[model samples]
Every structure is written in structure tokens, then in C-alpha cells.
Target chain A: DVKVTQSSRYLVKRTGEKVFLECVQDMDHENMFWYRQDPGLGLRLIYFSYDVKMKEKGDIPEGYSVSREKKERFSLILESASTNQTSMYLCASSSPSEAFFGQGTRLTVV
Target chain B: DQQVKQNSPSLSVQEGRISILNCDYTNSMFDYFLWYKKYPAEGPTFLISISSIKDKNEDGRFTVFLNKSAKHLSLHIVPSQPGDSAVYFCAASDIVSGNQFYFGTGTSLTVIP
Candidate 1:
């Protein structure tokens, strides 16, 4: 089965700490995205990479960054974790037809 | 501003009845619309999709209707089962922007048995 794997299902971090959430896809899809989901806000895109070494900012790119060194792996980085940044982070890879999502990582910044 | 909106935050329907969820988008450029079903603690799963050229698309128990003129869309579930209870999200893709999708806030649907 095709898979999009997120490194952690849950995480707890201290404020101001730099955090990394890694994602890997086995489908070799060129388009990959990172989104943060919250109550009453839905899934807001943080960033998306259409190809290796290429990235674009989404609707909400403030306070977050992304890296796509290889086609299969896309990493979302929280430069400095804050209490408000606590949300469910999701990774997705897409083909022309549809996008497949990971299990998601819930991050709590204390 | 939220480009896509799900006005109703929650909806409940009796078992074996039809459940309807609505969505509206502010952008007229969105050409492709999709519905996703999400269970708690899990990612949303793709449900049904409709292109701008088509007004309605059906897949088994689910049907999605798009009204291009009004910039609105609706998903109908026939005989909604308890298992159908979950958060439903409506997403839109602008073909001009390489099919990147924008999602609505989502509506929580409950099907009572």
C-alpha cells in the first residue's frame, strides 16, 4: 500500500525550542505539503514543495519553515516553538488524482 | 479571510435518513471541488470530487453537488449510518494554480442509530 509516514504521532516540547517533524512518502509524488489543523480553523497550509529544492509559502507560513532535500522526504521545522503553535501537523503527498495524508503529529508546546 | 467556508459547525441526522452538508467558497477561480471524511485522531480521507464543468458527482452513498454561479457546494449522504459520523471538509482546487487545494473549516456530522 502507498504510505505517507510521519515520524511522531505525538510530541511535547518546551517553549522556544526548535522542533522538526519529518515526513516521508513512498509514492514518489512530486507534490508534498505541510498543514497545521486547529479547532474552527481547518487545515491551513504552511508550505508546499512541488519539486526537490523548490518550495512555496502557503496561506500561513509565518513562524514555520520547510525543507525538501529529496523527493521522498519533506520536513516541517518550527524555528521556535510557541504555545500558540500547538496544533496537529499533517503531511501529504499528491498525484494528479488526489492527495494522501499521513497519520498526523500532534504537537504541544509548553 | 477564509476562501472556503462551512457555515454550519455541526449537523445531526437519524439513521437511514439523508444528511446534507453545505460549503461555500469566495473564490470563483476554483474549478475542482472535493469532500473529505475525517475521524478523530486520523487524517481526512478523500470522499468525492466534482469538477467545475460538472454540477454533480456520485460515489456509492455520497453525492457532491456544485453550484458554480453561487460559488457553493453540497454533499449528500443517503441512508447515513452511524459509521458515517465524522468531520466532513470541503476543499477546492484552482486549476490555474496547479491544483493546490484550499479547505473549509469543516462540519461535524453525527448519525444517530
Candidate 2:
């Protein structure tokens, strides 16, 4: 089984604060994704990386950036946290077929 | 524009009854479709999937039917259980497009015992 682990289960940050959410996958999958899920908004992609140094912007990448310095780790960075950014963050790793997800991190920005 | 759409925000079904969740997509280029189930505080898990080449796929009590002509798909759960109550999200991917997925909002289903 594949394991995707997030750094935090819950977090609270003040407005304008910078936040980092880390995700690591034990499996050596080539693809990793970052998504934010909101009520009635479902899962919106933030960023995705196909290789250690290759990154692609998803539909909703505003106020966010990503790093994939290594094959097993992907990080989401919020330059300036805002209330609108408060939502559930999910990380997933996959090959060409199915993807496995992390437990998720609930971020609250006041 | 939202390529994938799940119009029903919620659905209710009695125990042992059938639960049907619908999803529609506007993009004809989508070649692969997937359904995910999500519980509170948990990330969405893969439920089932169907490729454009097939119209239906069944696993136990869960069945997924796809209509390529209509650009729609539906998930049917038989003998619905309380454990089945959760949010179901529909997603589509264009295999030619690096398998990039476009997800619908989601539909929350509640099973009443």
C-alpha cells in the first residue's frame, strides 16, 4: 500500500502569515498533486509536479506555489494566508493510473 | 468554466435502498472518468472509474455507467448502508492531456437507517 503523509492535520494562521504544508509519499510515484477542497467547490487543483524539478500550474494556483526538490516530497507554500484560503488541503501521489491521497490538512486563516 | 458539474448538492436514501449519484461534463475530450468518496476530515478516496471505451463497470454493490454520447456518468449503490453516507466527487481526465483531472463540486449523500 502507498502512504501519503501530510505534516499537519490542523493548522491556524493569521492573515498575511506565510504557511507551508508538506506532503511525502513512500511510493516512488512520478506524479504528485496539491488540491484545496471547499464546501460545494469540491477539489480544486493548486499545483502538480511530474518530476523532481518540473511543476505545472493547475486551475487554482493563485496565492500558492509548490516545490518538488526530491522525488518523494512535495510542498505547498502560501505566500500570504488569507481567510479565503481557509480550507482542506490534500496531497496525492500517482503514476499514470490511480492516485493515492494523504489524510489531508485543514487550514484556517483568520 | 466548470467542465464537470454535479448539480445535486445532496441526496437522501433509506437503508437497503439504492442511491444514484449523477455527474455531467461538457468537455468531449475527457477520456477517463472517476468517482471519489470523501468523509469528514478525510481526503477523497478512489471509489470507481470507467474509461470512455466502456459504458459500464461494476464492482460488488457499486456500479458506474457512462454515456459517452451524452457526456454523462452516474454511480449506483445498491443496498445503501449508513457507511455509504459521504460526499461523492466526479472527476474527468483527458488522457492525451497528461491525465490532468477536472473535478466537479460534489454531491453529499446521506443514508437514513
Candidate 3:
């Protein structure tokens, strides 16, 4: 079994605050993804990394950035948190055929 | 435009019965389809998958059927259990982008015991 771990399960921050979400996978997969899930809208990709120190913007990448300094760790940074950014964040990793996901982090901005 | 769509937002079924969830895709280039199951506050988990070369694939109680002509797919869970109640998402991808995928909004399934 593969384990993808997120730094926080739940978080609350005030507007204009900077937030960082961390994800680590034990399986050493080549691809990593960050997504924000909203009701009725589904999971929208925010960022994805194919290798260490390489990142690509997904469909909804505004106000967000990512860092991947090592093979097992990927991080998502919210430069300035806002109410609209409050949603469930998910982390996923994949090789070529299958993808695995972390438990997820629920973020709230007020 | 939503390329992949799961029209039904929710479905309910009785235990020991079969639950069918449908998904449709408008892109003809999609060569691989996958199903993911998500629980509350958790990331989606891979459930089953089907490649374009095959029309049907089965694993345990979950089976996925793909129709290339219609660009449609369905997941059938036979003898559904209460534990199977969750949000199911349909995803599609092509080989051009190294398996980059597009996901549907998802359908919520509830199994009553």
C-alpha cells in the first residue's frame, strides 16, 4: 500500500494570511498533484509536479504556487488567503498507470 | 465546457442490490477511463479503470464498462453495501499528455442497509 501524508487535516486562517500545505508520499511516484474540491464544482487541479523542482500550473492556479525540492515532498503555498479559497484540498501522486491520494486537508479562510 | 460529465448528482440503492453510475465524455481522444471513490474529508481513491482497448473490466464487486462509440462509461457495483456509500468520480485521460486526466463533478451514492 502507498501512503500519502498531508501536514494538516484541518486549518483555519484569517484573510490576507499566507498558508502552506505540505504533502509527502512514501511510494516515490513521479507525478504529484494538488487540487481544491468545492461542492457542485468538483476537484479542480491547482498545481502538479512531474519531478523534483518542476511544477506546472493547472486549470485553477491563481493565488497559489507549489514547491517540490525533493522526490517525496510537495508543498502548496497560498500567498494571500481569502474566503473564496476556503475548500477541501487534496494531494495525489501517480506513476504512469494508477494514482494514489492523500487523506486531504480542509482549509478555512475567514 | 465540461468535457467529462456525470449527469446524476446523486443516487441511492438498497443493500444487496446493484448500483449503476454513469459517466459521459465528449472528447474522442480519451484512451483511458478511471473511477475514484471519495469519503468525507478524504481524497479520492482509485476504484477501477478501463482502457479503450477493452470494453469491460472487473475487479471484486466493481465493474466498469466503456462504450467507445458513445464515449460513455458506467460502473456497476453488485450487491452494494452500506460501506460503498460515497462520492464517485469519473476521470478520462489520453496518452498525449503523459496520462494527464480530466475529472467529472462526481456522483454521490448512498446504500441503505
Candidate 4:
């Protein structure tokens, strides 16, 4: 079975602080993605990396960035945390056919 | 514009009954469709999928049906169990672009014992 592990299950940050969410996959998939899920909005892509050091902005890229220094790890960075940024963040790795997702990190900004 | 849509926000079913979750997409370019199940505090897990070439795909108790003309798909869970309770999301992608999927808002399924 494929395993995608996330660094944190839950996090709380103050306004104007920076936040990092990490994800790692054991499957060595070539594509990694970051998404934020909100009620009635579904999962919106924030960023995605097709290869190491290669990143592309998804539909909702504002206020968020991503890093893929290695094939197994992908990280999402928030430049300045705000209350609007609070949501469940998910990481996914995929090949040609299927995608495996991490458990997700619930971030709350106060 | 929202490419994928799940009109129903929630559905309730009794155990041993059938549960149907529907999804519609506006983009005709999408050739691959998938269904995912997510629980609170957890990421969405891949459940089943169907390609545009095929009309139906079945796995165990879960089956996905696609209607290319209407750009719609539905997932049916037979003999629904309590464990099937979760938010179900429908996603679509064009495999030529390396499978970047667009998802629906999701439908919360509740199974009553």
C-alpha cells in the first residue's frame, strides 16, 4: 500500500506568523500537490510540483507557496498567516492513474 | 468557474440500503473521473474511477458510472455500512495533462443503523 504522511495533524498560529506544512510519500510519485479544502468550496489546488525544484501555481496560489526539494517530500509555506488562511490542508502524490493523499493538517489562525 | 459540481450537499441512508452520489462536470475535455471518500480530519482517499471510454467500473461494493454525453457520473454503494459514512467527492481530469484533478464540493453521507 502507498503511504503519504503529513508532518502535523493539527496546528494553531497567530496572525502575521509564518506556517509550514510538510508532506512525504513513500511511493516516489513524480507529481505532488497542495490543496486547501473549505466548506461548500471543495478542494482547491494551491500549488503543485511535477519534479524537484519545479513548481506551478494552481487555482488558489495567493498567500501560499510550495517547495519540493526532494522527490519524497513536499512542503507548503504561508508567508503571513491570517484568519482567512485557516483551513484543512491536504497533500497528494500521483503517478499517471491514481493519487494518494496524506491525512491532512488542520490549521487554525487566530 | 466551477468545473465540477455536486448538487446535493448531504444524504442519509439506512444500513443495508443503497447510496447514490452524483457528480457533474462542465468541461468536456476531462477523460478520467474518480470518486474519493473523506472523513473529518483526514484527507480524501481514492475509492473508484472510470474512464470516458467505459461506461461503468465496479470494485467490491462500490461502482462508478459515467455518462459522456451529459458529462456526469455517479457512484453507487450497495449494502451500505456504517463505515461508508463520510464526505464523497467526485473528481475529473484529463490524463494527457498528467492527471491534475478538479474536485466537486462533496456530499456528506450518513448511514443510520
Count steric clashes of candidate 1. 0
Candidate 2 or 1, higher TM-score? 2
Best by DockQ: 4
**Between prediction 1 and prediction 4, which has the larger lDDT?**
4
- What DockQ would you assign to candidate 1? 0.66
The C-alpha RMSD of each candidate to the native structure, in angstroms, is 1.3, 1.2, 1.3, 1.2
What DockQ do you compute for every candidate structure? 0.66, 0.72, 0.65, 0.76
Candidate 3 displacement at residue A63 in angstroms:
1.2
Candidate 2 per-residue lDDT over residues A1-110, each given as its tens digit: 77999999999999999999999999998889999999878889999999998899999999999999999999999999999999999999876657788999999999
Give per-residue CA lDDT, model 2, range B2-25, as digits (tens). Answer: 999999999999999999999999
Candidates in order, TM-scores: namely 0.95, 0.96, 0.95, 0.96
Docking class of 3: medium
Q: Each candidate's interface RMSD, rounded to one decimal?
A: 1.6, 1.4, 1.5, 1.2
Assess the local accuracy of residue A46 in candidate 2 as a C-alpha lDDT between 0 and 100.
95
lDDT of 3 at A39: 88
* Backbone clash tally (model 4): 0
> Which 10 consecutive positions of candidate 2 chain A have the poorest summed lDDT?
A92-101
lDDT of each: 0.92, 0.93, 0.93, 0.93
lDDT of 3 by residue, A1-110 (tens): 78999999999999999999999999988789999999888889999999899999998999999999999999999999999999999998886667788999999999
Model 1 steric clash pairs = none
